[model samples]
Target: MMFQLQIARIATAPLPVWIIWGLGLVTALLLFLSVLLHELGHSLVALHEGVKVRSITLCLFGGIAQTERDCPTAMASLRVAAAGPLVSLILSGLLLGFFPTTKSIHPLLGNLFGQLGALNLVLALFNLLPGLPLDGGLIIKALVWKITGSQRRGIQVANTTGRILSLTSIFAGIWLFLRGGGLSSLWLVMLGCFGLGATRNQSQILALQQVLRDLQVADAVNRRFRVLEDDQPLRRLSQIRLSSTADQRPANWVLVCRAGRWIGYLDDQPLRDLPVQQWDCQVVANHVRSLDELSCISDRAPLWQAVRALEHAHDGRLLVKNAAGIPCGTLDRCDLGEAVLHKLGVALPETFLAASRRQNAYPFGLALSQVVDSMTATDLTEDSV
Candidate 1:
């Protein structure tokens, strides 16, 4: 994840000696407090929902309460989301009650408080917009989930609504921009763009999930593969890859060949740290591991289950074998992602998958599964696919 800091936080910094420090300090403090309170709304609700509050970030975009886990139900999600805006609304109301009109206090303090109160009110209202990745969208998602009895379906509905809302917001922002609405209009356009990007990510995730639901390792596994031998040097194995044709890349493990029969697999970690120049000289057989140390599953296992295994093991790939203990094929995280993308009808080039595999990209298998499940549910419902 990218590191982010709240724009409201900058005010906490000491001002330059030459500037009007008092005014800057006062404005900064007020903005910080308001943003913090708004985020607290979300944190408190999430805590109530049995979700861990990771952090509350009060950035330029306002407050974001990061949670350790997603709420269990739509209602829980809604409540957690609604908490922040509700807090903001309550704060705004309190401010209003304290000063019916910002008429009596010093101009600076009064204006600051009034602005903070109004911003909170706006925050509450804006978050109530029923499009995804937003508080309002979460509410809609929860409602849809309640009605549909599927969280994935709710996400699809919410995401579709989010796209529609985002597009409309973009068009309106554009119109405002053309009509001389200034910087605020520009900000609106940017926000719409952000919404669009988030929607795309959600759509991709859903697609992958659907594919996982439909696929089984049995369908994709190649039954013929070599396993690492225990006695061979890492350098010798590296040479085999160097001499292979276009179809073969260096297998991470070579089959332990004993009397021309497969016995066990070898560990490849020792070879990983060796210098290229020493490739053919070192023995790798001593570094080999028995079959029990590795997690192997039959080819007929569901792709989702396999993915979960791969994730838990923290390995780049899993070895697929048949019921007879014969090495069948391997499932790399990248292969799963590519397969998911293919099912989604996304036209990613084969080279991208290959490159990503070589680079060892992070596993998004679980995310893909979730997305596919959501899309499948949505498609069945005819309301939002």
Candidate 2:
């Protein structure tokens, strides 16, 4: 273990290692720096458009610039999204111009500069492709959004186009592999698969954006989570869980109430970690994800609004309150994602199916109805703290 730790330290050392490093370490560093610069362009433009740039990440394929808020207008989005590619194109031009002068310095330097120029050009042009998860896709999405005034429709169009192109690339990769193009062909296959997987989520996003805009949080509120007093014993809660139906996705967290006031939740982990003898003495309030730590949204609010609320929330789960200012339900992140996939014609995972089968004996596999029926609610007091 100590040797492994030392090796990790050596590998992650701040200073670059010459020659010994693989993947053309110096070249890779230059590429990464260039990508970072490109992302900075997008960030600066997003700021100009009044959108807060949250983070810029450079990954294996390229980079992504995430903003705290989505652009309010298609024109604003177009400019922000186009900035990165424009930066790359500029860098490409500069490198190409300097490559000739570098030949007098050293052949190695000239070759390196030439390759950097080529890579930048390729980066700019590749991102111009009309597909999802690409700058070109964003450009197309913004244009379509502007014309139709429906972001969902724009996403659907890009998703469909990306699917066709990704499938074509996959076949092309396979052909190259068969012709002994070898490792490079394998890379193409991998890139195609990555693109395919990434774009698959677009369909769900489109469906969600459509449905959420029309529906309210009240329609999909989950009230099945049990509320427990903060003074309650861990053993008692554990017993309840062990005695309950053998649902694999059984509620792992319990809502905690302190003197009739709603706190956040009591995760079951501490219960299992604590000694059995101390279980009764250790009150839930001692370890809870506090109510103040979570965010609340109106149950009457649209589902898309709740989605936005979750994005701003730290824990990704919101305490859904009714008009009376009573915490009526919990809106979980996973639940929202599941709703989107369901709307996109994706079936629930097998774990959910198995859980439902054991939770209800309803005929015709309508256990979901029984699950809904089983959600018993206890009215919250005025001082539910």
Candidate 3:
């Protein structure tokens, strides 16, 4: 509605109210399309560089291209980062070029073309600002990576610059608002706050990347799980649960074995259905699941990989395997979260930890997947830190 009003106010060739509104709607859609195309430019270049594009999202702030991984090299990053703004600049030029021709047809049409062209130009230039969460910031990262051989350092510089730029934008917006600049001023203020928030989020991700660098799955492996022979009676399983602590409690799901080979697992949930008298009648094999169906991760692999596995796992848990390809223990969402927070020097509250253990999930819904992606993109490693 605001856009339509803005468009109506801009119309000068004396057009009907409905026609002006229609044109305004079209202009709004075209603007969104322009943002989509801008993101597509980045995604296409990322794909060409052997990176998989997961999704492209159009949000209130702008468009974002979520890729599975980062480019292989600095030059590749530069190419991918520059592609979006380059496409926007080209679009601006083309639209502006067509403006005169359209204006000859109708003033309203000309106005639409002119507005779109100018906005695209602004989009290109605005995104070119050298700061984190922006194309220009990434360009800066690529350059610094090429020059100093350290992407982490590049990220630090970019983040700092982003904070400064965001603050400046906020202050500028406030000045504009005080001078009666209205909605445009508020837009700038909101954009500034958004950018500031994005920069801080990236900073936290970088910190997590530091925590995960060169860390292995074995470091965070939880050994609280029990292994039970398939022939073992449910009564025997019940006897083992007499003594447990918060940190040493046995996992609810225990690994099942048959003839010295892992067969499946048994969940404690179903055991509650039977009476105590039936405990001796049921064997572990009665409720066994196939071990092959479980999501397994190598104990020696990077911890980040385990985090990724947990992120995609339906049950949010993984069966960890040792060097001999034998099941060692398990790593769940809580375990991974505890490990990460431990490294970051942050302690989880007992209540939160208890809740997470009860639900078998990360504490406070921490998003390790996003942090892992950022870590992968920045080439963060132990040596880099």
lDDT (tens digit, per residue) of candidate 1 on 280-316: 6766655556665666777887666666666655455
Q: Which stretches of candidate 2 lie over 4 Å from their true place?
A: 1-24, 221-300, 305-385
Top-lDDT structure, candidate number: 3
The digit string of per-residue lDDT tens for model 3 on 234-337 reads 87777766544545433555788889998787776546888888999988788787777778999998888888888777677888999988999888888888
Worst 10 residues of 3 by lDDT: 243-252
Superposition TM-score, candidate 1 onto the true structure:
0.72
The deviation in Å at residue 102 for candidate 3 is 4.6
lDDT of 2 by residue, 1-385 (tens): 2222323444435433343353256677788888898899999998998887778888754688877665777898899889989999999999989988985676556666777888889888888877888988888878887888766566667777888878888999999999998878987788789789978765543444456555678866776467788778777678768866765354544678878887677767787788889888877778788665558889898666666576577655677888977778876655654554555566677566454434422222322221221111101011011
> Against the hidden reference, what TM-scores do the models get?
0.72, 0.59, 0.75
Model 3, residue 328: displacement in angstroms? 7.1
By summed lDDT, the worst window of 10 consecutive residues in model 2 runs over 376-385
**Candidate 1: global Cα-lDDT?**
0.67
Comparison by lDDT, 1 against 2, better one: 2
Query: lDDT of all the models against the reference?
Result: 0.67, 0.69, 0.82
